[model samples]
Target chain A: MNKTTNQDPVVVRNPTPSWRAILLCVLASMGSAAWAGTPLRVCYVDDRSGVAADTGIQSFNGFQIAVSEINDAGGINGQKVEVVSYDGKTDPQLTATFASRCAEDDGALAIVGGNPSAPAAAMIPVASEYEIPYLMLSAGTDNLTDMPAPFHFRVGPRNAQDAAAIAELIARQGFKRVALINNSLPFGTDSAHATEAALKTSGVPVVIQQTYDINATDLSPQIGRLRSANPDVIVVFPYAADGARVLRTLQQQGISLPRIVARSALLNTLRELAGDASDGVLVPNTVDMQRPDVKKFFDSYKTRFGEAQPTMYPVLGYDAAKMFLQAIADPAVQKALAADELADARVAIRDALIRNGNYQGLQGHAGATYQFGPDRHHGPPDQNWFVFVQVADKGKHLVAADLATFKPGS
Target chain B: MKSLNTARSMLAGPALILLVGALVPLLLTSGFHLRLVTIICIYTILCTGFNLLYGYAGQISMGQQGFFALGAYAFTLLMSAGNWSFWSALPAALLICAGVALLIGIPLLRLRSHYLAMATLCFGLVFAGIASRWIEFTGGTAGMMVPSVKFSGHIVSRTELYYAILLIMVLVLVMQNFIVSTHMGRALMSLRGDETAAQSLGVNVTAWKLRIFILSSVLAGLAGIASAVVNRQVNPSFSEFPILVSILTIAVVGGLGTRYGALLGACVVVIAPQGLAAFGESETIIYGVCLLLFLMFMPHGLSGLIPKLFGRIRRKAASPAPGVVKAGEIKP
Candidate 1:
């Protein structure tokens, strides 16, 4: 509770301090809440039951898989990995609360979660304040790793990378003009901004750009405006249901322009909602499904979780959990744990991550590896993190599209 | 005897609440617990404003969170962006909230009951949208950061902030007690009791409603500042719909018109989930059930039930023993 931040003018100038000493004694004791135990604890702070729940739920599923595999394989140096889960409900303030709660109340060694950027940003300061190691699953908003954060790390492609890839595809296809439409959520706005900037830089002029409310059921006006702009291609940033609505309106208006969704809002629900209208929409995907390990992991995820996310979500989750769990198994971390030094254990875990910096898992491009050090947190962005795919079979499948030669609806 | 009861409700109730609030830090040993209690104080302050507006003034606003967010942003921005001191930033924030409420309340106070609720809800949503969309000023979804308060060339600590928020909440309740004890308080009760009748009885209904609205909004702003100081951060989540609903729930479940109901409601809404393991992940469900149960069976709310129970006990105490009918028997 060392958070006194009020502005009392008379009190400030009165040259007297009230009740500062006793408060420190209490907080000092509270800071020692973390105690070493047989079962090591980590907290997963994610949106489990909100609009983007599938992403969080799938990531958590992958996180659980790693925990189970590790515990089954004789634990992290005989100490089983335990996970405490919190549903952030897509709110950053709520996420911050969960972060602090895990640090001070749950005594979590590290916190790993988030499928969105805002919540991820919220966790950073709290993690820094509490000195808890935090690993984010998939918050690819481009600017998250703009500065160096010692205890915070992320595993995902940047929105800027996605935008640049889409722009390259658009230029390669020789499209005349592009129209960009997005939902008004932060994710959408951010993606649209990035994509617009990339497009402008790539010599493709955006003919029209507009945003609709996230919950708007009727998008005919926006779709009609899209038709009026008469762009050769369209890039949309929409969540599942809204994506369906936009597609339906596109069909109704008979605007059969080539549509490219610039981000991860392309979900199974979109295809289900849009029916045949979602047939030819293209998406920039994170998972390169051709890799044997990636394919096997996706197959196991499908068999285990009832449905795979059909994206890079599970990989990101699995990779983060694997790295964190493995880092804790080091002899240095075990020494701190044996001594019941929770504070030292946290610092030890951070050091272990830096020592085991070349963490290779099923995330990023085929050859990409994770890194952590004093000056690096998010690591070097993998330029090849993206793989292009097109929606086919009434949204039942996403077939790989060779951007160099693929044409729309061919 | 009536004066005794009035004094109990006015002075004694708030005094006791303040006493308990003041002693929470020493009793609770954990920083997390202290943090939770500090949050509880913030929510209580927020519900106080809501209580005055909806409870006494006979207005229901689904947009209380809007005022809350406005206050938070104004305070944070003024302090962080304007480099204003905490003392000056607080008054500026309150003034901004009052100004906005006054401008809106003039046209808005004309609407009655649910219509007003709908309009205010829209206001809340619009403000939330602006907080999220207006990225440059509010920091958008990432939220704005607040600097810690310093005093006399020294850093003010967390304990001081906790006490500061607690003191503010108690003062708000005391002020509320003071407000309801005056002639204007009677007018407010009359307005809530029957608006048309109050107007006929020579009450300046519109003027009173506007004043209470401004007052309520200003209080909400104060709460936002307190919360920002505690978290040292303010995000769009401060103005989201779930928060607005929770505040309304606190008002309804604690009995709409009572003075101490805000504290009771804040405790239920804030402490209930964290206190018990079974309540985890089911916070929303518990709140729904609590609201529904209170609405259906105890229509008067928990605050109402307490007094009724007390009255029943008092009435039973005054009843004469069944076998002791000496006076009547002597007459016979």
Candidate 2:
């Protein structure tokens, strides 16, 4: 039985270029921009027009929708938020340039970007140099959250979290032997290594480990090797398109060992591409589709972006932006904003963000909370941020697997 | 006197550009603007080196990106991982790149035209693959962070680094001119015009090609180091085929065979897109349209056309109808 609510979908207006526009009159109740008596500036450095454009566009829409929603209902402490956006084009150098611009040129109080770890790697130095608080929407690289980076925080699962969560499920399923495979992406390479390490630590024998090049045509070789190793279950770390290829290749080879994959495999395209082969593949997912707030967010995304099916990216964006807005809403940050002290406001915002304890956002599973501090910089670095979901009916339906009682062949 | 005048004309565009480039940090003190200009300077070096190889030497090797990546990774790994000083790391990176270029150039120079291009393209692709797969050294696709530059005991500030890169850019320009004026420059031009004729004229074709290839790769390595320091990081993206495409775009846009083509091309390629950043998603479209316009109308490239246009305008002004006075000219 599905319980439904009547919350209206998000409304999108005429597209407005989000570069520099002079702040308009706001009621005295709503706060004004800091330092310049302008609207509060935040830069969203996204990869909007490159190989990973879909993920970037979804993230931007989610971020923009949140800004719109907040503005529609009296902005943060009445101070409207302005997002100065940049399309990084997936170039790390370009991303670095834009991040530098976001800090020095745009005078943004906070910076947000980095889905893939490459741009995040570029942004991390800029964030540290400028002392800007950078919140990644979704990056699985563990070092991106390395300690001593007070300014860096992430909203989604880390490589370790995905690895640990999947490893736990594999162990729970009572599978005696496991095989781990991953494509040679930052996420895949890092996650596969982490997953292997986790499995090794859990005393589970990894029968085989193989790394495939991204965009490889025939994974029959890899599948053949995996089959020869005779793994009871296969764990893969790959993005959607490649994950589909892996499924197709496996199906072609008639290998039916159940597979477990990382969060990227849960992208909407995976379901479309994998089709029937996606049936029993497991994914360490960040957001559950059944939650009411998730439903509301999905509806809002559909209304705003015009697509009913979106990947996990928008949810990552929404949660990160919300947490950032929440930090700015702190009283000390408000005081800095009210005094029109831009530098003080930026520092206060960073300080407030690092002090974040127990931030419950939309990206994580039920009861997952973030305690960001000096030691715990990765927003919600815990494994609870991910839940295991088995793709059923070509990703048309999902059957949530209970970690405690997960059966091996179900 | 005529030779002196030609030399003056050659220096004019570059000297003026360098003077303005020197004043950029003074005028705009923002970190972002400084970083953007630093990138432009690095692009200048890359385009200049690429221009020498492809534009003038008639070698369309797409392997500069591989050299660039090697330089960046080598320099960063030495500094951060090996704890080597900046002074030693810079030259080591350059030398390593030159060495690799020399080894590859011997056999690669034997191929003609597209064969060479495809082979060098594969070289770059292989380097990028290695950069990503050799995760321990290159950090895979996540890239590795570079430590702030410290020469001797003093740390180089951002302003200081910008000036240093500007100085290097100016030096590269001077080197380009120097190369062009030397006897070897004539040999290069001859070879580019007709390899058979140059060979007949006693130019050692393979040796010359190898020498220029090594020099161009060293320049690419220098630019790569400059970029790594400017961004304070290096990733496999630096060596991706897309980067090769962009480098080629800059080379062609500036006109392959002009004196100051790289300088003009670097400005257009690096700065134009930043200006269009305000347009959001349409930025790419606007940039493509601008590039298309340049390709359509300015086949001679910006570096080659501007001076001729200026000369025509000056001549028209000087010889204004035998008896009529132009504006600002007084009649007796």
- Write model 2 residue lDDT over A127-226, tens digit each, in one string: 8888888888776676677766767787766778878888887887788789888997667777888888889888889999998978897888888899
lDDT of 2 by residue, B1-332 (tens): 97887587657766887797776666554565567678778988988888888777888888889998889998999999988889889999999999999899988999989999999988898998888778777777767888999867788999899999998988888788878877778878887888999999999888889988999999999999998998888888889866787787787688887777887777677666666775657889988887888889888789778888999999997775878777897888
Interface root-mean-square deviation, each candidate: 11.1, 9.3
Q: For residues A144-208, what per-residue lDDT tens digits would candidate 1 score against the true structure?
A: 65555668877767676777888888887988688899999877887888888988888889999
TM-score (chain A only) for the predictions, listed in order: 0.86, 0.86
| Pairs of residues clashing in candidate 2 | A30-A78, A31-A78, A31-A79, A33-A38
Error of 2 at A377 (Å): 1.3
Per-residue C-alpha lDDT of model 1 across residues B173-208, encoded as one tens digit per residue: 888998898787898888899999999999999999
Supply the global lDDT for candidate 1: 0.77
Relative to the real complex, the DockQ score for model 1 comes to 0.15
